[model samples]
Target: MWISRLSRFLDSVKQTLFILGTGLVIFLALRNSIVWHMQEFWGASGDFWQRRWEELYLLFNQDDFLLSVFGTYIFTTAVFWLCNLFFILLDLTGKPEFLLKYKIQADKNTPLRPADFMKAAKVALYNQTVVGLPMSVMIFCVMKWRGCSCSPADMPTFPWSVVEVTIFTLVEEIGFYYTHRMFHHPRIYRFIHKKHHEWTAPIGLVAIYAHPVEHALSNLLPVALGPILLGSHLATAWMFWALALFSTTVAHCGYHLPLLPSPEAHDYHHLKFNQNFGVLGVLDRLHGTDAQFRASLAYQRHFLLMSSMPVTQQVPEPPKKKSVSE
Candidate 1:
């Protein structure tokens, strides 16, 4: 389940890194319109993004309009791919020694298989294309509704506002925690939030696979909530979105890496529902939703200890049909 340091630079590594390198290039190249989308794409629809909702198509017709529009698409698509690449690499090179060094879960679940991966890939891509584009447009509209501009010249400069980023992430996490837990109500879980629970053992790609309503209510709105509430700069808003996406994906990544967000609790939620509902697990523990899960973790430790103890005597199993030679 591990690879040597020497194999790190082998052909497989070279090819994987090449693809990621190309993706990073595309991600950086489309930077301008990526920021512009939040500022200009639907800047004119400040009304509809709030109370109107019908004027969502409002546009500026400014110079280089076409380029900005195309760039927005390219930028967002690239962002999704880049995020996808990060965890996909973990799952893809699942046996790499580097990954084994950080894996937290003592027991390995089912081996990562191609069929299951393809299914997750299909769902993840569907959510990005379906939910991601519309969400970007909505972010612009809401910014406009709140009287914020998308013009980079007027926006915050290079190197985003970290202070604002932390504040925004905190606000989003709080909102997401409450709303996500609410969605688990027995009356609504079956119809509204059940799609996300389909995968008991989640991978990186499984993070984005949710019903559109869940994506909008729990995922998009909460993330955009902080920026809209604070009226933060466009650049700050974009950075917050990136962070939000990263945290969400990491939570679904089955492995529990030391420095990472500790996704095992979330992993447990997928396997055994009705637990670990909070984004940061704060609410889950405070309200005792994770009490059952924490107890189970302790139990797993005990089981491992019992299994590892030396046996004084061996018990033989019933013999199967004898071999032809025997």
Candidate 2:
């Protein structure tokens, strides 16, 4: 049994490695050209916008306090709303036929009521302003004490920025995996983590609809620890935070659009509650928490969708086992 599990685990790791390699290749090939074009565009921008941009950048760098208090709040709020509103609209529209094909939990997630949206929005708002703002201040203090650089001149180059974010992702995966699994302990689940699991078929807005303690430990700390440990540039830290928020929202979006990361694994986590407790699948595989997921029909359906065609839940049959003689 252990041997079979190890084989499956190895196959998943190979797939993850292949995806990582392909992403790095593409990022390396395009980043220089992209940066060059961006610089050219900035250079060509008229004096009016250029001055405004400079002023904004200066203001952002003027003090870590302002950035921590206002910048984090504003940036996270904007990204959260932008990402979730799009999906909220889709859900409000009964998930039009065009998108219905990709809805992972279509059967389970019936149309949400107005009150449901209100409850989610209200809790999300409280978390963002009431809970998040103070936490941001604390994180800023920690980062500053740890000697993280906020200087624009000291910002990492694009490749190094990528490297930093990658490390941040790995750190977050480890932190989140263990903290999340711990939350599932019966002694603690109801008091803290249960609120997050309220949306069994999660929507985008519900991504951060967690208990404040759970939000702080599982959602915020994991993402922040990497930059703090590395003493990364403030800019790099913010970039990673944005990506983390967006990706977490996408993971809970319930729709598996083509060209995006598959939501199947997380959607399954929401459904079953006991499997897939990590941001990335790395820790889950090592801990064997994903055993049931790997054996389930959803595992067969878990795929990188490349076509606009509608997806179905049809699980293909396993191949016949060969006899020793054959």
Candidate 3:
């Protein structure tokens, strides 16, 4: 039954792929043209950086600034939708069971109604704004005090030794792993992390979607904390953002990819309400949280083999109707 359903879905996906491929080609062409025009204009001036700054300020005249703000909203929403679509495709292709098991688990275990999902979305938005905006301001102040003119283009060239970035990433990962596990403790779960765990079998949107406190703690630790402690460059910070976003999305996707770890590795923890708290495999392995996961996998494999035997298999029947008198 699963195979038949998957085959039909794939047939539909073929059409989707062709349309998506055409749309992407057009989008890339338009984007590249706009970028080229902007670069040409900037390059014509002898003091290109200075002129570019002037252009930005001028372009952001009160009315334009408002329009730009709206534009940002549209751009962000579009990116999020695209990411969601990609994850849906990944779920269909890599783990058809993801969708199949979702209804079963949600009905059985999770208390996630539509209201809960809305609340989580609100929390995610509020927390990101509250934490990210202040951190950005603080970073700007520090950069100004240090006499640094770190702009977007200069981000790639901003001086931070590779060793420093590497050390910072490791430190941040350790902090994240421990803090995440700590939140799962029964004493703290309701206050800090329960909103997130409400979606036991999550889709991609739940990646950064959490209670305000949980969101601030989870997001700020890796991105803001590392930069502040290490005095890292804009480039390092940007790289961290990319890594964090991509990893979080993949983790929440609930599908295993060839190069990435299985979402089953994390999804089970959410379902069972404990264990497997590490972003990567290291901390979970060290703490023995993965032991049950290994055992469960072995049991499932054995069960599948046994169930596949013709002699052991039996067809389930519809229940008999009850009499009106009963």
Highest lDDT against the true fold, candidate: 2
Poorly placed runs, candidate 3 (over 4 Å): 1-82, 88-120, 138-149, 152-165, 258-261, 298-326
TM-score, prediction 1: 0.64
- Sort every candidate by TM-score, greatest first: 2, 1, 3
**Candidate 3 residue-wise lDDT, 254-299, digit = tens:** 5444445346566667767666676654555555566686566421
Range of the 10 consecutive residues with the lowest summed lDDT in candidate 2: 45-54
- Record all residue pairs in model 1 with backbone atoms less than 3 Å apart, i.e. clashing: 39-150
Sum up the clashes in candidate 1.
Answer: 1
All candidates: TM-score: 0.64, 0.85, 0.56
Which residue runs of candidate 1 sit more than 4 Å off their true CA positions? Answer: 1-73, 97-110, 157-160, 294-326
TM-score, cand. 3 vs. native: 0.56
In candidate 2, position 225 carries an lDDT of: 96
Go through the candidates in order and give the clash count of each. 1, 0, 0
TM-score, cand. 2: 0.85
